[model samples]
Target: MKKDIDIPEVKNVHVAVVQEKHLEYKTIDWNAYIINNSDTDLETVLIVSQGKSETKITPPMRHTIAKLPARSYAKIEFLQEKVLELNNTFKVTFFEGNKMFDKTYVFRKNTINEKALQTLPLMQLRGVLVK
Candidate 1:
């Protein structure tokens, strides 16, 4: 058997906010800070981050796969908005509680002319710490 290492497993999950600069032909790096920990088992942790819209907030248009330990970042690309185009803007709000967690990461995508790389990899997630 292989030796196991120790790391802080996430229990709760939430997006601090949605952030984007360009919403047109260009691409931008987006990150959803997932607050989580191990449920019962120390080794197994569940982190769920999905893109959807509700009465309170509008979800992301296009996003990569959900949470992954090794790859903790995602990209938001714009194809076309039938009714309402992004035009570089997004928003989030505090919604009710559920099995996952009661948290929100409001975001707006900004218009970017050219392609640019994100400066920071994983920035500190700040907001009301939902416990």
Candidate 2:
């Protein structure tokens, strides 16, 4: 017989975009992170970018996390050429204890103050997942 499963709340996870500087070329790089803060372990975690204009900025990048232990984070590095502007949204999906959960995070060009770009390893955006 089939059984009902509980759907995990989006709040259990966290996501962030980080900006890093290249030491050799002195250029900027962007990366995404999925942090699992809940008590359950996440399986088949997938991070995908959405929106037309957004894909142009970064060519439809996707990252997968086979398993994300609770209280840990998985990083997805953006290795493409730097673009002057970025306005995009990312969706993160994963399963916890037979329950599925997903959330999207939107980012505008000004999400991170332009001035802050001067600093290395800066967190461009950060927030808890929400439905």
Candidate 3:
């Protein structure tokens, strides 16, 4: 007799905020990304703020990921007139194998590097989802 075995699904998706500096312009840029570590692709990806207050507090930001391939990443750029506090929260939702998953990531204000403002062409903030 032959038996069938069940395999577990891979759910190793992560979200991060990357800060890059431009020496020529003497400016710093911040970008958010959704990183997929699973073997399967994540479809119908949607990322947004968790609450109304969070949305109102932060400057205008855009989420630009329609689909995230396996072992790949998608970037989200923020369009702001002024640099606000780094503390923020986001909700990430995606589908994998007919199953949907959602997670929340928080970027603390403490992670912000005040010194990075004086420096140029440097990576300032890097955040990863905990657990």
Candidate 4:
């Protein structure tokens, strides 16, 4: 009975980081997002995130999206300059139809910078995407 449940593999879902400019503050900011590229809607979407390294760990932050329509995206959280120095991890879980899917996406330490900017799929904003 333990292995009878079917857990489908997550595909076309990703966590990405992007840079934003605050026109009023005249400063740049970094933010994280979840992208759903599949053709079906995802329900009960939940994302838990944290940052950690050899000697330090940050509190886990959680976010929930009631329903993420196909080929859409949602903002997860804003990334601080200090948090980017640690390895950031996002655990994503959601349901498609009657099946469940789960996946963990991570942004390695120091990897979410301007130099890593690229054309993001679906949402055309330039950012670092975790595939």
Per-residue lDDT tens digits for candidate 2, residues 9-83, read 587576655566768889876555666767778999998874335356456778888999877777765534243
Instruction: State the lDDT of candidate 4 residue by residue for 1-131, as single tens digits.
Output: 97987778889998999999878888899989999899989999999999999999999999999999999999999888999999999999999998889999989999999899999988879999998
State the lDDT at 88 in candidate 3: 63
Which parts of model 2 have CA positions greater than 4 angstroms off? 1-8, 21-28, 51-58, 79-84, 114-131
* Span of 10 residues, lowest total lDDT, candidate 1: 90-99
TM-score (C-alpha) between model 4 and the true structure: 0.94
> What TM-score would every model get versus the actual structure?
0.25, 0.66, 0.63, 0.94
Worst 10 residues of 4 by lDDT: 2-11
Candidate 3 per-residue lDDT, tens place, 27-121, comes to 77655566787787889887784222344565444464667888787666542323335456677777787777777776655443444333211
Top of the candidates by lDDT = 4
**What do the candidate models score in CA lDDT, each in turn?**
0.31, 0.62, 0.58, 0.93
Candidate 1 per-residue C-alpha lDDT over 10-125 given as tens digits, one digit per residue, 9 for 90 to 100: 33333333234456736543433433332321122233233333322234343333333432423323323321213223222221122222223333332222232233324343
Better of 1 and 2 by TM-score: 2
Candidate 2 residue-wise lDDT at 70: 77
